[model samples]
Target: MKLVCTCIGCAIEASCPYSAPRFYLGEGQAWARHFTEDLTRENIVKGLKETNYGRCVYKSDNNVVDHQVVNMEFTGGATATFSMCGFTRHQERRIQIMGTKGEIRGEEGKIKVMDFVTHENTEIQIPEQTSGHGGGDSGIVRSFLKEVCGYNGSEGLTSASASVRSHLMAFAAEQSRLNNGQSIELDDFYKKLLVQV
Candidate 1:
């Protein structure tokens, strides 16, 4: 449920209640569209991407957050917190989940699931034989359309009803960030969406 990327950091750079840059491109920089043209050093240079790329990452953007902590409390009193920053060596996601009976932990490749009662630990070996990662997207779309999507048929990949929960959570997070990390009430936020829907 977490999306971490340069775009997230860039968003903070671009969006502040009062300090965001205007749509106009700053002088002597490549047009914004070129930023996503290609990652090759030559293309990146030509694109003249992100306005403040030449400046120190920490000092460039005006009001965006390079690092921040967000805390959330669910309706049933369960809680979650996440920390994000532009500084990291790895580009993949690692995750851990704890429950009353068992726990699951791992990154993209291998995950370990353990049962508290049985005391049995299982090791899942993921073999990609490339990228040193367990999984890669070689024929995922074909398999998906021929398999999962063939049955469900993209019913809710991006429908508003399917995405409302995540979208609302993101909105609340942004609101909380701007409000000095104040706690947000989900009920209050959801009600506002109801009116709009």
Candidate 2:
């Protein structure tokens, strides 16, 4: 199996909310719901002001890398590639997955599926949602609440250890990137961290 993921950001003057002030300070703000329970204009504006939503990416003093790509191999021998870039005309994420029997591709809320055996092709278009990440934010929130309410089921929820491993993978990837793309074994990296701790 193989997977490829990309996150590309738009320019500062583009209409994308990631780099445009309109998303937080202008009339076209789409993420106001994330601010306060009150949908009042004053509250939304005030909440956004307290955050860094409208900051210019080019002038930011943070150490965020503008572009990066990480290649990973899973324990099962599956390979994956994740890439991020801030120099694009549009802000969007694209993902593609290839397996033994079929392949799937998605971008900008549209998904395509292909069956290798029957040679069938299918396309799916997700409805545009204002609730953020195609309404996935609410889904995750609800799932978290369920867990907090004593739900023991693992469906739709990531295990804590699995989550930690995912984060460690990212850290190791960044370490490899800093070391000129030198390969680093995840198990050894974790052991070294444990020793330091």
RMSD of each: 10.3, 8.9
Pick out the ten consecutive residues of candidate 1 with the lowest summed lDDT: 17-26
In angstroms, the error of model 2 at 122 is 2.4
Model 2, span 30-98: residue lDDT tens? 556566667676776566545554344555565867899898888999999999998775567889999
lDDT of 1: 0.57
Model 1: how far is 16 from its true place, Å? 25
Q: Per-residue CA lDDT of candidate 1, range 70-144, in tens?
A: 777776777676667755534455667778899888766787999999988887966643332223344434445
In terms of lDDT, the best-performing candidate is: 2
Residue 121 lDDT in model 2? 98
Clashing pairs in 1: none
The per-model lDDT (C-alpha) reads 0.57, 0.72
- The residue ranges of model 2 lying beyond 4 angstroms of the native Cα positions read 1-28, 31-60, 149-156
